[model samples]
Target: MRQGRDNGFQAPLWRAIAVYRIAALTYATILVVRNVAHYQRPVLAWPVVAVMLAWTVFTTYAYANPVRRRPPLLIADLLLTAAALAASVPVVGRQALEEGKPTLAVAWHVAPVLAWAVAGGRRAGITGALLMGATDLIVRAHRDQAALTGSVLMLLAAIAVGYLVRIAEVAQERLQRAIELEAATRERERLARDIHDSVLQVLALVKRRGAGLDGEAGELARLAGEQEAKLRSLVAARSVPADGDDGTDLMTLLSRQESPNVTISGPAEPVRLPPGTAREIAAAVAAALDNVERHCDPGTRVYILVEDAPDEVVVTVRDDGCGIETDRLSQAQAQGRLGVAQSIRGRIEDLGGTVAIVSAPGQGTEVEMTVTRLT
Candidate 1:
């Protein structure tokens, strides 16, 4: 998602620049009035002061909108500053220039540099400062120490302000990311609560009822019991934050579902997985167990095996219960009973994994789930 631009420093920086522009205009007007008698062309001086005042008012309005501070406007602003500096040579004459007297614009030239710094960071600031500084030196026709000193100060101000602007942008980006993460966490917690109140409770009841039954009904009850345990573990673990590293150990989480009727066997070492992939695989296993509990005998034996390969992880859930007929799944789907399709197959597919079910009418059922790490 695109983040909103950070304007945290905009108001204060522009406010200060507006004040500086007005003050500089006043300063320049006073200098012009004081030096009017010394000018070779006194008549031309008043018109230049009038132009400077008008431009200052226009820039103050233009710069208030960030979109107006683009390259074209910034370039024009610098050009205008240079023009004002050049006008001093004609209006104030060579005597004042040689004496290092402040030009008609005085501190007004800094407006362009400050604008560039706020809009384009260090590079643009340096460009604007250099343009103004070089123009001032050329108009003076000599390396006046005061002029050089002013140029150096302006350069330093541009660099510092530009650096601070960059820092603020990075801080704003991190703030946006933190906001997105908090929102996602809240949504996950809400979903977990809803699942607990409905799905988890239903599976627990099915497990309890099938405990003492015989034949396929007994096997179905046992399968329900295993699924109830697995789902509960998944829901509980999901409520807590997962490790930010590779992921939580898959074997450790799956082991939590082990019970008298459910045998879980895996490697002794930790089998790591990305947190999201691990949770989906665990949930798929729970759904497969739910299927067994609803269809197989209560005393049916179930085995869960975990294999950690170099590039992928594989989990297999097997049940020695009355097997599924060839058309059973099709019939279930047609009847709008989507427990197997949505809960098991749909989940694995969404994770870029594969689900393979092997079963027959009298034979046992085996579901193999595989997810690659690259996904």
Candidate 2:
């Protein structure tokens, strides 16, 4: 069985197991001392008890270290505890056991079952519990309600501990994600302040001075003003609450680009992805559109189709514009103009996705991107 990461998140659980071991050991020792006179071999019983004491002390310290809580340690603990429990057949005669004499290990054997559950989760813990429980039953010469009840109780305890550990690990993951979101929010606020103080102020001044100017100067001012407004909106940032629990929806971001010339089509339901992943996909889509806008004539219609499947997402961006010549893309890369390479392919490939661009001299161009869903 594979062990969980050796983090201190489960330190309290380990400590509780250690405390339980010591307490169970003490109780078992008291029982043996009180019934020593009735045992088949009194001298042999003392050595078995001594072995249990030594093992109890060793495991109390060994299990405290996360690194040592692996299969080798857990397996050895279960086997050794089972051996001690089985030793009762010889130390205390079968007749004495049938007369209701307690086993040599008594309640001390359940410690390893809990250790298994904590280290390898429910399945591993249940395995240990069943093995120990069988050993407990075999040690008894007589069968009764009390004997059966002890095994059932140990199995139930193991299941409960396993579930608790799983819940704690999930809670830890959510807390870590929250910390990252808080840090991102703080960074956005700082950048917004800096942009408002400098870049936004300069753009506002440029617009005010060039508002009355004619020809090229007025046109430049208008473009600058448009960029400023877009920048402001970008800095404002989106509220997490508005995007639902799965970050920003890819469909929501792409649908915003729709216009008379740009037609968007996708599933009626939202296509959600992780926040960072959704942003990268949207940016890649934007880059593809920008390519079409730069090379195509005004109002040359474009079609965007989104396909959301169980295992993957497929987005196709096609434009009814002047397609590229065979060597144009390679030439652009050689000239250090990497708009397609960096913005389109780079973004998708970084996310473990793939992009395919098809074009011809007179035919329209098509860019298909596939991003696999992360489980």
Candidate 3:
């Protein structure tokens, strides 16, 4: 995901440079026309015209081809601005010598201040101010009443404009980064919620059942508790796949199903299972616990175990509650109660697994589930 975003971020730099080149040239051409009359003398007008054209062409080419060529463009822009300002010196001198006071002819040379702000930023703005100030000083050297204060103010204004443009660019970049982080965080939270409601619910029941047993049942309960703890740790761990399809720990799914009120028992080691198989088994375990919670006494405990081998994984969920009567069990199923059939047995069936119930009068209930893992 990050690689794709980086590629997108870099894609526009070259294109933007290319467009800026055309825009800079167009701006230079308009400036030349507005000051055409002052350049009636071929020696003064032609040289300034040539320098302006060169500045426009060189800057355009440097910025257009490659976005990574920023250093070269920066150097070139600075050099071109210097050359253009140098050419203005002769024209400014001729205008000042002919006219008694400073005229608009010299003012025309300061128009490049806008270009400096657009292309080079704060440093360029400051450089442009210094260059403009020098030219103004040269033109006003012959006049007694020419003010230096106005030239200082103009330089300060150009520098301020450049800083503002640079600040706006920085703000835009920060805003884009903030948006991407927010999106990634939201996706992580959504997946966490799904895991909590489904797989985690089943593990809680198993842990509860494990806490109430004795002897082998007690050992099974201890194993389930371990599995429950592992699942909780995995969920809290940052190593989980960002996308749920990357993979999921089967034992972790079962562990997440645990609850304080429900005792559980399960396998000692994690039983590797595919995502589909694990999802079904986890869902079945949850439905079984839901039955225990809803139909059995509040104090009932459950036991869970996982038997995994080369071809299949099996899960057993048992509850120490009043055993289901044969007639009542049948009646519960007939009255549109699909909790066990659809939520438990049906899910395992979809994953090529089998579910069986073992119970009799005066005895607790047990559910055995087997899912064949396809290599």
Candidate 4:
């Protein structure tokens, strides 16, 4: 992927490279014209400089579009630049090069190294630098400080540009994340305001009015009160602090499902899983709990168990409720109720995991999800 922001420092860097190429081309052309008299093949030097000028113009437009900046184009740039440098050997003549006269390419060869650095990072930049530098040195046919200076500078430029590219990518990623977080925060606040004005008020009223009644009336009141508290907690809950790029602690999320009627058990230490995987598992568990809440009697017991292993993680949500016939599930799917299939089964399967649901009439439902971790 192109490493830069929508409005970032990296975009300007490419333009800078193009500008450098143009300036270097001009410098090289001037040197070739001025020193033509000293050249062994004076007529040949102009053609080499002309090719460099054409390439400079080509790359200026080609690299401006990000879609054209791929490995194939980068490879072509590096090889063609090396070829231009090699052309110096015959055009400038070996003896003149030995006498310290500048090659036909001169500063123009470094442009490809900068392009590699911007596109592929430090290692790729270094590779390009070494190849071009070696070509320059071999074409010059000498090994002195004067011959090595350009190569060393190219290496340094590659390293610097590659490092800066990495930093720019990180900065852009963080900036995008910050913008998303701000938008999410605003939406959450608006939703909270609406819930407070409507749902919470209605729930509180039901709890108060129906509390003194008997049988299902009181039970309904208790459920409403419980839902009100859960909704408040849901809206007010803070996100768990991320544990670097490794993953999120799965136990922390599962523990959040704990309630007066629900029990969660897991390893004492943190059970770390990839963030997306952990959240999907937690959501599946939540879906199981929801099924228990909607279908089972009030105060039905739900137990969540998490098992962490080297190659896999398993989460089981078992509820001691009035279980249904297995055929009922198929019937429900056919009738368009897909909470169990989509939320619980589909989520685990999408992550390359397995979901085994075991339930029978008069027996409780047990949802066992096993996700194998990619080492």
Candidate 5:
């Protein structure tokens, strides 16, 4: 299954910021409309109001897309905010500026501070807040102690919000990583179960049968006994690290399935496969051997050849035993025996591979499994 990004908080956070911007714009508009007649140049102040309204709409739209909230737009936004604060001087008259009366921008000045906070964290937030606050002081000419306190509050708010956003982003990233690790763990456990049921059982059977045989068969049994130990160790050693992709040498996994009676041949170079895919293919091969052990003579020789082609990997398991009659499989299926159908064909088909069995009454049996590797 594909993992999803932890962006659950993103939409709500942006929406809250948008709502705050609109509310601040409304508050600024009310302040301007109420004090228009008191301004030294009402005409100049009216135009500034229009500009503020336009900027509010533009920033609201632009900030919705993360791409537009970067340095270029944020810097422009700060400039506009500073310009608005400066514009209030001539518009509100020298008497109002000296007395430190409320500017037309009012609460709307917080928008740029928020943008910087969201974009670049605490440092950017403090920088933006200080720039806008300094402009407010310059426009006022005489700083009221009340206005200074408000400026300090704005600075604190910017730092707090920026720090919180940074913390939230870090938490979200960790949550995503934990989710991926859990998925990988579950997949590995499932693979372990499947391997235990099919592959380990077949290896144990080979070891047991080979030990009781004589001469060449006994030597084959000794090899099978050694492989059984190696297979167990390999399975125990398999680990699903945090990265999710567990790399395994397909040849090494396949080679462990070898016994004296069943000879395995593959390339000298390691055939690397995704851990899950390699496990399934190996289990499918084991299922094929299980069928041979149950139906054929104990001494019947089997050959397992692995070919790592450019476009696909092919594995052929051939046994020199009495071949299967065409009706035997159907009869077995009808009687509720699905070893070949479910264990062999079903496993291969699930891995997006094909399994072809070439068998006739007097002829030996050969199961060819092919899995495509896309470039």
Candidate 6:
């Protein structure tokens, strides 16, 4: 980020730099204009002219360049500050010698410290203080009545401002990071819901119908179902990267809180399922029962069982109803009807598991899905 030269300790670093550059130029222009009557006095005019030119060039560079150019910019800042301080010493010296008392040189000391705070960052501000202090000492060293106490107090204040400027820079960076994270999380959730409702749902239906049929037609439905489940899982696990990506996870991004009707049965022990296994298993079971609820009897009794073992976790859902004929499902698939083929079988296989269907005429359908956890 780039900002102009207004180096207020509280504002963002870039804006401070931009403000500093403009203020420095304005100060230089005003100094020259106000001292127009002193043009003939080369002793005073020449140094002011030199300092004005140096401050303009340095402030311009600091404002234009980013943090990548900080090294070179920092070096130039130090040089410009040194020149400004050197110019101030002679001007201050002439004042003390003529007036016999030290007077405030606003352009010489105060403006330079403000410029350091804006364009040069913390180190630059400290450098300005040291130079300002040195210039005060130079004029005071010659006299027994130099105000050492006031000069030291002003130098310490400049150092304190430098540390405050650093704190402000850190705070700005953190705020930007937090905003980016919030936006990404919201986008991920939206994608998940869309995929789950439309794409994954179609795939699940295809798998279920395929399982209902027998022979070659049933096999085809099974293949289509497996593909859909994998796609859904992939969509649920994705994340957006720093470079800005529209990424999403299938389960989390797609599935909503709209609870599915599921019946689970198994041992009391927690099943050690694979990464995507448990969620997909639950989805497949829910999809199956949905089909049973819609196609079979409204009061159909469905049973779910979870078997936990050392190698695998098996989930079985059984429903009592008339079994499906193999031939009718093929004709349905040809017409692109995927209700049973994609939804159930495809989901189970995607989790590195198997879907077992057992049915014969009046002997109701039973689906046994087994997922093996690799750890």
Candidate 1 structure quality by residue, lDDT tens digits, 128-186: 88888888778776786777998899999999888887888777766866777688778
| Candidate 5 total steric clashes | 1
lDDT of each: 0.80, 0.86, 0.63, 0.86, 0.80, 0.57
TM-score of each: 0.61, 0.74, 0.44, 0.74, 0.59, 0.42
For candidate 3, the C-alpha RMSD (Å) to the true structure equals 17.8
Candidate 2, run of 10 with poorest lDDT: 236-245
* Strongest candidate by lDDT: 2
**Candidate 6 residue lDDT tens string, 103-143:** 22333344455446445555666666677666656644443
lDDT measured at residue 325 in model 3 versus the true structure, 0 to 100: 85
> What's the TM for model 3?
0.44
Clashing pairs in 5: 220-260
- The Cα error of candidate 4 at residue 332, in Å, is 21
Model 1, residue 297: distance off in Å is 17
Worst 10 residues of 3 by lDDT: 1-10
List model 3 lDDT by residue over 1-375, tens digit each: 011122233335434444544565455556555655654343565566566556556654554443524545554555555555455446545654345433323443444554454455667767767876776566455434444665777587677766765676667676765676678668767777887787777767776876877888777766666666656655664432322323445666776666545544556555666777787788899899888878887557788877777788888998888888887766867999888779988898888878899987668889999988786
lDDT tens digits, residue span 127-213, model 4: 899999999999989899987888999999999999988888788877877787778878888999999999999999999999999
TM-score of 5: 0.59
- Alpha carbon lDDT at 120, candidate 3: 59
Q: What digit string (tens of lDDT, one per residue) describes model 2 on residues 282-319?
A: 99999999998899975678999999999999999999
RMSD of 6: 13.7
Q: Sort by lDDT, best first: what order?
A: 2, 4, 1, 5, 3, 6
* Candidate 3 Cα lDDT to native: 0.63
